[model samples]
Target chain A: MSREHQKYRAPDALDHTRELLGKLAREVSVSDWHLVIEVRPDDLPEVALRLRDDETLSCKYISCIIGVDYVDWMEALYLLRSQEHAIPVRLRVRLDRERPEIPSVTYIWSGANWHEREAYDFFGIRFIGHPDLRRILTREDYDTHPMKKDAWPHRVRRTEWRWEDIERPKRLPGETDRRDRS
Target chain B: MSTVESKNDAVNPGSPVNQDGPAKPSFHLEEMILNMGPQHPSTHGVLRLVLHLDGELVVSVEPVLGYLHRGFEKLAESRTYLQYMAMISRLDYLSGFFMEWGYVRSIEALMGVRAPKRAEYIRVIIGELNRIMSHHVAIGDFMLNLGAVTPFFWVFRDREDAMDLVEMVTGQRMMYNYLRVGGVRWDLPDEFEAGCRKFIKEFPAKIDEYEELISDNEIFISRTLGMGIIKPYEALDYGISGPNARASGIDWDLRREVGYSVYPEFDFDVPLGQHGDCFDRYKCRIEEMRQSVRIIEQALDSICGGPVNIKLPPMIRPPAGEAYRAVETPRGEFGVYIVSNGGLRPWRLKLRDPTFSAISMIPKLTAGNKIADLVAIVGSLDLLMGGVDR
Candidate 1:
């Protein structure tokens, strides 16, 4: 590996990032993969802008936007990478499960447009200022947010016609109803 | 749908019924909406492009995907880490090993296990060979899209030799579940080195023949020279990677940038292009194949015999932590992000497919260009819907 890469390593590489985000973010934690910072949903746009424009950070590339449903709340993780420092950081915003909404960072990084849409498609986490927040990986009329823990898998086909709606044959005097069998 | 039509009709008010009388006959040039395949041949897979056109010039292009969405991520949530291996190879069918490598590496990192030096070298060699194979298909299909049929045949014919060599070691042709968590599934076969050496020695001349046949052709040059130009900043902004990003004069390659696996020891150049145009993208892939060959030769010379796989329990339960590993797949930076909750199955596994970002830029690139140029631009991007949709 190059000397510069060896110099930064992982722990110290994002030390400055931790320091910078400490002022703007609610919490900062380092993981094996990246430096994670927790930000409020309302502060996501401003925090994302600073991470991209701040000279010390310069995280211009938005690698991905991942949504995880923890049952109680939904979390949105923004994976950001800096071309200048070759360091990656993850900024996370926690949302209410009842009404998950956060401002979109499409203005800061154009790459996040599709990823945000994908998160919305599966998790139903609405992006406030998104240009077009429609279903990306699912059909337009798909009703359920399939990636949520409580949501059913999209492959399960649901029929509109119920068994009760079907006309039953005349039962014999001693015969039992099919519904009673269950 | 109604809103979109009304908006389009309002902006482009040139219907025949609304035209002013005889003497000033205005051209009724309403915007045309064209759907180019979930079934078209040149799309390479089930990808649909909804194109808005004004007379032959493309006004906008929206890529409609998910025709092949099998819910890989949701499936991963239910299966064990090892069980998910069966599906990883199918992510990018053209280059399966790299996807396997990315997934295995992430788990290995979380588990804190390291592959031996020899196994690392083997991984590098096979990975580079897969890279060459993928580029062959890409360049071939790209040429075919541009109306050159002969090069496609030649390229695929050359790729078969590499495929046979890989099959010899992996025991399968395409979906080689050859990579495990700590290392490869099996050691190299007796003749693996000899076969690789012979192929490496012969591949450069085939590349030269390809250049002679297509690179300098006047028609090909005009069609590609300045087409689909993505500036360096625009490419970075869109998070494009691999040859597409390199063609835009970015000196970023995960092999060199992050230096994962045994790639740092290999001395090879990351080929770059001056202009970020279609021609530059083609040239970059061709040059990258040469670099792959160079890396393979060095790995073959320095590789030593050792254990291929490390011992582990029947089920692998990585520690409760998140691990993200990125590898330089032929398409671009294929990364696997795994969040482990100390269980047999992953809590969340997100595949950051490079094609996802690369294809996202298609709409911007297709604007103001002729419909014919759309094919060249999309072909040069070398997107696989399998990877994008997954």
Candidate 2:
């Protein structure tokens, strides 16, 4: 709650963010405040817990977690928040394509459970220590995770059988129905 | 707070293993793994929850997602900046206005552009109306989940009325992509004011109907009153927002705290709850709908006549920077984080679904409750799987 640049409290949120970040982590250069934490894969969950629990850094809320598939590795970016201080923290965890696994922070904040699961199911990142880590929003029998950049499904043409043509009656009960054959 | 410290007795304390094998020595009870959904109506979507059940009590819930993954973010990377606006509506199908508003606000923040005063007024009016509509459906769905059939019909009946009002203005019922980069797509039609006025005047009484029907019903209270209780500290820690946070006695609303657009111009109250529980969450929503009606009335009275949209170039390429915009959706705080590359397409676009935190709160809320209570807790969260899975 360090008040410095309260003018952009509502409007011009970016400037407000820059000033707040400057106040929080004094060592972080103002220029590099946007991309704050460059964390290793294994260290991410621990860092996240500290951010959520430590009184000095109670960033208890994870606003969003996104996964981007780059050519070399998959990048998982988390946007977190501290409503009391009105500050936002950005954390990144990049995993190589060969072995994409990271610990789950769902234990720290229960809200991260489904989000982490979604990231794992779609991006193919194995969430180590995730309780009941299973596919959620996908079809039960669907073979592939649709969002994975590397995987592509074989598309097939849809077939529809019309009932009118297939069940054409041979004889009508009364007068002969108009029969037109071409 | 420390009570939740999980014991290794329930699960193996050894290193996490990915292989399918016999139960380890540390594993005490043999838990049955069950797939909750793919087609089950309770799940609300194709969402499949892999559950480890110790009889009826759930030991763990593993959520599998991507059934409704339209790859919106991936698709946005290829599309032009302005074109991506249309796609935001599809991310959270339930509350499209918030999704659109969040994206536009982010773009405006990055580009340093502001909507006109009149446009801002309209934005508040329409956004609040959208909130009301969302709550209607949410309450209805919640009631349905609680095994209450009458409330769902009654809630949706009013929700349709709100949808009719939206359709008249935008010409689209569900996904009204009426929000533009700097403002709205069009001005409110002549009948729009009258329609809104009619709704605002009658909405309070209709809410009374909801109270008499559901709120006063002893069965509803027994199902919800004390179930899924959350404290303010826990609510904040878990990143719960909107009605969910308010139910926990947290008196914070982005509409008031953040005060984006012309929200400050209108006089309205941010509802708070004394106890955070399923009942409080339910009451918070009903009260919010009332507040929305009040806000709409104020905005309409102060609504000035002018161009609804701001003029901007067809191709939008903001300077290289990042912008994050948060809006109070019915579920919670809906945020959009966008990274611009000073090009037609954005470097990265991420949507923060409010339901994500609410979903995470599920285990906490339902851990000790009966199986029936779990259904009530899920409904109380009022999640949209589209946004969660997107």
Clashing pairs in 2: A135-B64, A136-B48, A136-B64, A136-B65, A137-B64, A137-B65, A137-B67
DockQ of each: 0.41, 0.27
Off by over 4 Å in 1: A1-10, A13-15, A153-182, B1-22
Best by DockQ: 1
lDDT per residue for candidate 1 within A70-170, as digits (tens), equals 78889999988887777778888999999999999899899999999999998999999999999988899998888888787553443455778777788
Superposed on all Cα atoms, model 2 deviates from the true structure by an RMSD in Å of 9.8
lDDT of 2 by residue, A45-155 (tens): 667776676564467767767776765778887777666655556677788877788888877876676677677766777889988677655555667755555556343
- Tell me the TM-score of chain B in each candidate: 0.94, 0.90
| Model 2 alpha-carbon drift over 4 Å, by segment | A1-50, A53-57, A68-76, A92-107, A117-182, B1-35, B50-60
For every candidate, C-alpha RMSD to the true structure in Å? 6.7, 9.8
Name the candidate that leads on lDDT. 1
Evaluate residue A113 in candidate 2 and report its C-alpha lDDT on the 0 to 100 scale.
69
lDDT per residue as tens, model 1, B324-377: 888999988998988889999998898999999998999999899998899999
- lDDT (CA) per prediction: 0.88, 0.76
